[model samples]
Every structure is written in structure tokens, then in C-alpha cells.
Target: MVTTLLTPVGDAPWSTEEFESRLRAVPEERYHDRHAFNIRMHSGALSQAELRCWIANRFHYQRHLPVKDALITAKLPTPALRRMWLRRIQDHDGLEEGEGGIERWLRLGEAAGLDRETLLRGDTVLPGVRLAVDGYVNFCRLRPPLEAVAASLTELSAPDLIRTRVAAFERHYPWIDPDGLAYFRSRVPQSRRDGAEALRLVLSWAYTRKDQERAVAALRFACDVLWSLLDAVAHEHCPEGS
Candidate 1:
């Protein structure tokens, strides 16, 4: 059902503008930022337990960010591309111990009342959440480099989401420490930079109809992955329907 919603390949190669439109269309239609779980989060409807559950499960996805980036970097064909992609890995992993997005996410977990050790160990990651994240990682590992880059175009929507989330957390979830909000705050600029680079790469590399179709499909698949992650979180914490 999700695959069926992707922009279909056409006989004629799309113009660059058309391809950009098709790529942007995925987030409008299917980005997980539209999911009910996130709507509740933004509206301050989630209970503290519900919020903690989300943070704990989402940490699993956060931990895999660099792994997926590494896979994409390994597949890049040029030193320039590899050099550009390596920044994504570093953004998540940091240059030294106890830094980067993953560490900041742990602080978020702790602020939300989740045990830091338990969060780091990832023992409570929901089954569906694990599968969705692993699927994205495997996609990066096995797909063509262009498709993998295209998948990361999900970052296009992330900066706006991070901004909204930061404001929501401050306005609604005041119990969380200000310092623990660093993860979302830090991502706003980083995602803008990363998304621009990924979009440029997709536009330049996927020049033909077939390649453009694959790029669109890859982005659609990524949307599905994120949506599935939220679906899992919702099922676990809001089973009666939020």
C-alpha cells in the first residue's frame, strides 16, 4: 500500500524541476511529522509516560543514524561525495567520546525519566521500531548510492519539525530540563545543511527517468520507515487510539 503511493515512473524523463517536485511530494503526503503520535506530542496531549516511551524507542533509531550514514558514505563513488557525507556521520557520532547527537539523545532520555544505561543498552526498543530502523539501514547498505542519498532527503522536513518540537517541549513539557533539549535544537541547522547537500546529490546523480523514479521511490520508502516507527510507538503507548 505504501509503495503504491510513490510517484510512478513515466515514459519520458522528468525535468529537474519535475523531479524536485516529485521528491518534495513524498514529505507532503507521507512524512511521519504528520503522524497522530507527533500531533499529540506537539499539542501537549501526551502523558509523561507516553513521552518517555517515545524517547526510549526513538533512541534506537537515533543510534542507527551514523550506521546508515556510514553505509551511504561507503557507497559514494567520489572523494567529494564521501567527504560531504562523512559530516553526517560525525554529526551523530562526534569527534570524541560523550558528544554528538546520540549523547544528546541520552540526556533527553534521562530528562524524560528513562534510565541512561537502559536507554544506551536499547533493551526496550519496540519490535516494529527496530524493524523499521533496520530496514532503512539495510536500504542504505544495499541500494545504489544515488537511491541511498535520496532516502536521506527526509531531512528536508526535519528542520521545521525540530523547530516546532523545541517550541512545543518548552511550552508544554516544561518539566524536561532545558539542557536536555539540545538534541532537537542542534538538529535544526544540521538538518538544513544535510538536506541541502542530499537534495543536490539526488538531483545531480539521478538524471534519467529510471534513476529519478528510483530516487523518488527511495524517498517514499524512507517516509514509510519513519511512519512505521511512529506507528509502533503509538501502538505501544496509545493502543486505545490517542
Candidate 2:
């Protein structure tokens, strides 16, 4: 669901604010924050199993983040951009093992009563989750660097979502160790920093009408990836006492 499209049917490139506005608009309607499962989650209505399902399945996407980021890192045209982007990969993968976002997520899995090896093995990962996550990786691999980076623009909406998610978990799911929430906590500031850099790159590189449109299209596509992920999760896991 974290992959990284659309047009307003316009014929010209927009001004800087207008271009950024268009990018922001996609998530307004399409962000997975509005998904039924996520809405249920925010309401603190999800059962323990449902929450564990989300935690484990999201790990599928989480593990691939560095892979796709590495692809983006390779495509960055300059050392300055590359250096800026390398932090994203490191943030997820960590400077060393037993550190960073991926490890923190494994801890999240453990806190949800999932075994680290089992989550890493991915035996329970649904076909749809795999497909959607793989699509996200291929997107970064094959698309223009501009579009690839734009796809990551999902980070633009992430800080707020993480904020609400953390609060919801703390409020509604007290059974989960607050310590397990580090990944979400860390991402609030990290996403903000990353979102700013990504928007800058998108604005600086997407100078033409076509590229601007492609950026928007990529954002919409990212939105779809997130929605599809939730659909799969919701379909497979029924809430308690349903």
C-alpha cells in the first residue's frame, strides 16, 4: 500500500505552488487513511488478530522500502541528491542490524505476539499484499527517477497518519507495549524531513507539463497501492465477534 498517478486533464505545467497543490490533492481523497480497515483501526475497533495481521502484513512493505530506496538512490543524478536520499535507506535498514526501522518493526511484530522468524519468513503474507508491495518496488525500479521519487511522496501524508495511529494505539490498544510503537514515533519527524526533500526534488525536476502531470499520476498510483493493501488485509481478516 506504500507504493508510489493522475491528471486534472490540464494541458500546461503548473506554477510551483500549483504543482505542489496538485500533488497534495491526490491523498486528500485517495489516501488509505480513509480505508475502512484504517478507519476501524483509528476507532480502536480492531481485534487483536486484526491488529497483528496489519502489523505483520505491513512488514512485507516495510522490508522492501530499502530495496526500492536503493533503486532510487542509484538513479539520483547528483551526489547532493544521492546523499540526501541515502538517509532514507539507512533510516529503514539501519546503520547496522538490530537497529533502524526494519528491526523496530520486527519488534512491533513480536509485541503483537508474532515470532520474529515467522514474520521474516512471511508465510502468512497474503498474495495480494505481496503483489501490491512488489508493484511498489518495480515502480521505483522502472519509472523515471522523477516519478519514482514522487511515488515516495506518500511520505507527505505520513506524519499526520503516524501521529493519529500512535495516539490510537496508545488510547485503544493498551495491550500493545508502548515501546513497540517506536517505528511510528520515529517516522513522525523522519517523514516530515523526507517529505520536504521529496517535494523539493519533485518541484525542481518536474519542470515541464508532462513531468508535472507524471508526478501527480505517480502520487495517485501510490494512493492506489495503499488502498489495495488495506483491501487485502480487510478481506482476509475479520474483526472479533463478527
Candidate 3:
């Protein structure tokens, strides 16, 4: 019989490469890209209603991204880190009204036939989605800055997922306006840049073995939060009997 042994945390201080590998490994095992909902989405198996529900539910997550970033920003110890991290806020919130990723997502909601006002209202957000998204925000708020920075390393896997999603949208969901795809298109490059910076910060800050373990644990928590969000969406929109 074969049994798998868990890799014990705090075994030793990881080299930069090893630490990065451990961080990247979380996505391999737990990224939402592997979720059943995303697989169906990529395969074009989701119905239009299902797609709309996903957009509406995911908007809650998108809207909270800046909030989480802000929490992380508050924990940064240096002005340089704060300055560097502030761009993430600007990327989501923009300099003015009618701009930024949030606006683009509202357009996506409109393209999906949802009312922009209604999506913003968020009355339809699932309780589990709320818990998952809120859990992410609170984790950033409460954890050590290094762990919070590590949590954002989930961006490392995001560029690939965004690329796959963009292709899936273009190939299968042509009913959505091309303009509505701007959110995913914009994220491809942004996530790459952000992920690189975040990985650098995590590698620099988590120099001790226990610190490295905490960073890895933070990243795993983020992956689980994202997976839970999708699980909630799947349970609601793709129930087994249906």
C-alpha cells in the first residue's frame, strides 16, 4: 500500500527558489482554475443563465479586491512597499468614476443582461461567497504583513487562468460584447507584473523557516478561499439533480 506523507512545515529555511516553488505549488494543488465550475466554463458547457449567475456572484469578489488590497497596504512597513502596492488599488478603483476594473466588470454584468445597479447592490450574493471573500479581506487585515503579501502571491497563477478564460469567452460566449472582455484582457499583464513583485517581497521577507511556513500557509489559505467561492457558485447554479 502506498501512503503520501505531508511535507512538514518549518523543516528548514528554504532557499529563494525553494520558497517560490512551495508558493507556486499551492496553485497546482488547489487553484480555482481546477474547479468543476471553471472546467465547465472553459468547455462552454455552462448555460447562459448559469453564466449570468457566475458574473453576478463573482462581482462581489471583484468589488472586494480593492478592500483587501487596502488592508494589505495598511500593513506594509515601508513607504516603498506602500507606494508599490497602491497601484493595485488604482488598477481596481481607478482615478475617477466610469473607469477601472470595477467599471469593466459592471459592463460585463450588463452584457450578461444583469442590471448594473442590481449587481452593485449585491443583494443576490451568496452567503458562502460573502464568507469566502470576507475571509480573504479579514485575513489580510489580521495577518502579518509578510503573510498577507504571500497571500497575494496567488496572482502568480492568475495570468494563465485569465488567458484561458479570455480564449473561452471569445470562442464560446460570443453573445457577450467584445468590450465586456476588457477585464480579463487587462488582467493578463497586470497579474504577471503584480505576481512578480509579490513573489519578490515574499522571498525577501520570509527569510526564516517559520516565516517561510507562515507565508506558505497564507498562500494556501488564499487558494482555499478562492476554491470555496467557486464551490458556492457551483452548488447554487449547478446542483447535482439539476
Sort by lDDT, best first: what order?
2, 1, 3
Per-residue lDDT of candidate 1, residues 1-242 (tens digit): 45655555655789999899999999989998899999999999988878888898889999999999999899888899899889888999999999899999999888876789888787778999999999999999999899999999999999999999999999999988889999998999999999999999899988779899999999999999999999998888532111
The candidate that achieves the highest lDDT relative to the unseen native structure: 2
Candidate 2 C-alpha lDDT tens digits along 1-242 = 77435546576678999999889999888999999999999999988989888888899999999999999999988999899999998999899879999999999888777789988999888889999999999999999899999999988999999999999999999988889999999999999999899999899998789999999999999989989989999999634311
lDDT of 2 at 139: 94
Number of backbone collisions per candidate, in order?
A: 0, 7, 0
* TM-score (all chains, Cα) for each model: 0.93, 0.93, 0.93
Clashing pairs in 2: 1-225, 1-226, 5-217, 5-218, 5-220, 5-221, 6-217
Displacement of residue 165 (Cα, Å) in model 3 is 0.6
Better of 2 and 3 by TM-score: 2
Q: Write the per-residue lDDT of candidate 3 for residues 94-114, one digit (tens) a residue.
A: 989988999999998887677
lDDT of 1 at 116: 91
> What lDDT score is found at residue 229 in candidate 3?
86
